[model samples]
Target: MIGTALRGIFTLPDLRKRVLITFALLAVSRIGFWITVPGVNYDVIEEIAGRQAGTWIDFIGIVTGGRLTNASIFSLGVMPYISASIIFTMLVKLVPSLERLQKEGPQGYRKIQQYERYATVLICIIQSSFIVAWMTSVTAGNERLVPNATFSFRLMAIVSMTAGTVFLMWLGEQITEFGIGNGISLLIMNGIVARMPGKFSMFISNIARAVRQGVNPAKEVTELAIFVLLFVGIVAFVVLITQGQRRIPVQQQKQTRGRRVYGGMRYYLPLRVNQGGVMPIIFAQAILMLPIAIISSIPGLQSIRFWFNYGTFWYIFAYVLLILFFEYFWTALVFNPIEMANQLQEHGNFIPGIRPGRRTAEMLEYILNRVALAGGTFVAFIAIVPQIVSSLMGYDIFLATILGGTGILIVVGVALEFVQRVEAQLLAREYEGFMRKPMRGR
Candidate 1:
C-alpha cells in the first residue's frame, strides 16, 4: 500500500518537484541544530540539559524540533512566527480595521501577513533576549552556560537566535508556496519526527538490557507488538476526530430579474468537530509547565508537587480540564458565529431551517458549543494517552509520547493533510489517488 502510494505520488512531475523541494528545505532546517550560538559553554549546557531531562525542555525539544539547552541558532524554532500569527489572527477579529482589511481580499491579506512578519521579528527579539538572560544565570555546578555575560556577547547571542528563527519563517513560506503541504506545519512535523531515531535507540537499548539481565526476549517482543497495535488504534481515532465535522445545509435566496429567476442554490457549511486542532493541547502544556517549575523551586511545595507529577491522578484531572477549557477558549477566539451569521445574511444565504440574523447566530453558537465539547474531550484524552500508557504499562514517557500525545497528533495530522493535498492534485490531473488503486476497465 505504501509503495503504491509513493509511486503514484512521484509519477506526477509537479507533485514530485514539490515533494523534493519540501524535503530539501526540511533538511536545511535541521542543519541549525548542530550550529550552537556564541558565548555558550557547551559542557555546562550539556550538563544542565541532562539535569533538565523529563522536563519542559524535552517537551519543547520534541514539539518544536529546536534545541534550547545547547543555545543553538535555531533554538527559537518556528514557534515565534507561529505565536505572531496567532496574535494577528485574534487581532483581525478584535480590531475593526484589521478585520475590514482582511475582508478586502488578497492585497489586504498580504498586508496582514506583512504585519505578522513584523510581529514575528519583535517576538523573536523578546524571546532571544530572554534566552540570553537565561543562559547567563543557568549553571552546571560552578560553570555558567554563558561564561562571558558581556553586552557584546548578549547582543551576539540574541541576534543569532533571532536570525535563525527568521530564516525558518522564510523557509516555511517558501515551502508553502512551492511544496505539497503547509510549510509551517511541515517544519513542525519534521522536527517531531527527528526524535524518532533516538526513541527507537532507547527502545532497543531497553530490550538489550532486559536480555542481558536474562529476561525472556519473547516477552519483550510481545510488548513491542502490543505497543505498535495500540499506537495504530490511537492514530486511527485521532484521524477520525481530526476529519470529523458537521455540515449545516445552507440555502441561497432566489433573486428576481425581469423575466428570469436566479440563485436559490443549496450548499453546506462544514464545522469541524476538532476545531481547536493542537492549540488547546499546546496551551494546556504551556500552562502546566509553570506548576512543574514552581514545585521544585518553592519550599514546602515539593510535597504537593508529588500529587501533581505527570501521570498522577491530579495531573491527569487538571490536564484534562485545562484541555477542555482551552479547547473552548481557542474555538471562541477563532470562530465568530455573529460574524458568520451576518456574512451569510448579507450574501442572501441562510441555514435551511434557521432564520437569518439573530436566530442564525444563536443556532450556530449553540451548535459550535456542542461540537466543541465533544472535540475538546477527545483532544484531552489523546493528549494524556502518553502519561496513562507510561504510568499503567511501565513504558518510557518520552518513547510513549511519540506513540501518542502532541507528537503523534501533529505527525498524523500533517500526514493526513499532506495526503489530502496530493490526492487533490492527482485527481485534478486525472490520475489515481494515493489510497485507491487505478480502476480496471473492461
Candidate 2:
C-alpha cells in the first residue's frame, strides 16, 4: 500500500507539491492553535474549559481542534466563517438578487465568496463579543474567567478573534489552492484527530489502574476493545456509504445527419447515496446546541438544568430528531431532481425504460428519497450511539466520542476525500489509482 501510494504521489509533480504545501499550511495552522489571544489568562480558560466538559464549549473546542479550550487567537476557528457561508447560502436561496448572482457562474461565485468573507468578519465580531461577555461572567467562587473585564480587554479580544478567524479563512483558501482536500474541513478534522492519542492513553491508563487495584480489568478492557472494534466498523461503513452511489444509466439518442451518426452512446450519472455529506449533521448540531447553550447560559434556568444536560435522554432525543430533520432539509436544498431531469432531456439522454421529462425526475426523486432514508437513519444512529454507550459503560463522554460517531465520521469523511483527490491525480498521470488491480509483468 505504501509503495502504491508513493508511486501515485511521485507520478504527478504538481500533486506532490500541492500535498506538501497543504501539510506545511496545516502545520502553521496548528501552531496558531496554540498561540493564545492577548489579554486572556490561559490557566483560567483551561480550568474553566475542564469544568465545562460536555457542554457546547467542548463541541466548539472539538470543531476548532482544541483551540477554543486553549483560548488561542484562533479560538473561534473557522466556525464563524462557516457560519457566515451557511447564512449566505440560505440568503442566496431566498433573496432574488443573490440567487441571480448564484446563477451567473464563476465570476458571480467569486463575488459571493467575497461577500461571505465580509460576513465572516462581522460574525466573528459578534461571536467574540459574546464570548468575552460569557468569560467575564464565569466565576468559580470569586475566581472569574476574565480577572479584569475592561473595555480595552473586550476590544482586544474581539479584534484578536476576528483577525484570527480571517487568517484561518485565508489559510483554508490557500490550502484549497495549493494543497490536497478542502482546507476548512481538513482543519476541523485535524483538531478532532489530535484528541485521539490522549483518549487512547486514558483508556490504557484506566485498564492499568484497575489491574493495579487487584480488580479483574478484563471486562473494562473487553468493553474498550469492543468499542474500538465498533468504531472501526462504523468508519468502514461510513466510507462505503459516503462513496456509494446509484448509477443511472443514460443512453444517448442517435442523431443522424446525411452520412454520419453523431450521438449514439451510453453512460451513467452517478448520484451519491449521501449527497448532503456531513452538512446535515453539522447543521443539526449547531441548531440543537443553540437551545442548550441558551438554556445553560441563563441563570434562571438552573432549576431545570437536568432537562438540558448533555447525554440526558431529553437531549439525545431532541438531538436525533434535529439530525433527521436537517438531513431532509439539506438534501432538499442541494438536490434538484427537476433541474437534473431537464438537463438530461435537453441533451437527449434518458434512463433506460424511463420517459424523458417529469417521469424521469420522479423516478430519480423516488430513488433519492429511499437512499436518503437509509443514510439519514445511519447518521442519526452514529450520532446518538456514543452517548448511549457512554451512559451504559460509565465512561467519559469524551472517551465515548473518540470510540465512535461524529468524530469518527468527520475523520473518515475527510480522509476519504483526501485519498480520492490523490487517486484522481494518480489516474490523471496514467498511474494506477489506489484500488486498481496491479499489473503483472510478462
Q: Pick the candidate with the highest lDDT.
A: 1
Best by TM-score: 2
Candidate 1 residue spans exceeding 4 A from truth: 1-5, 43-50, 137-144, 210-215, 254-264, 291-307, 436-442
TM-score, one value per model:
0.90, 0.91
What are the lDDT scores of the predictions, listed in order? 0.86, 0.80
Q: Clashing pairs in model 1?
A: none
Over the stretch 1-442, how does candidate 2's per-residue lDDT look in tens digits?
Answer: 5587677696578987998899898888888778876766666876776787766787776655645667778889888887888898788877999989989999899999999999898999999898878777877665666778899988998898889889989989999888999999898888788778877887688799998999999977887788788778877787888888888889999999999999879998887777666677777787766766677678887644578566777877877787777777777777788989999999988998999899999998898888778777878887877787777877788778775556777788889889889877776666766886543331
CA RMSD of each candidate after superposition: 3.0, 2.8
**What are the runs in model 2 whose C-alpha is more than 4 Å off?**
10-12, 64-66, 140-142, 208-223, 292-305, 438-442
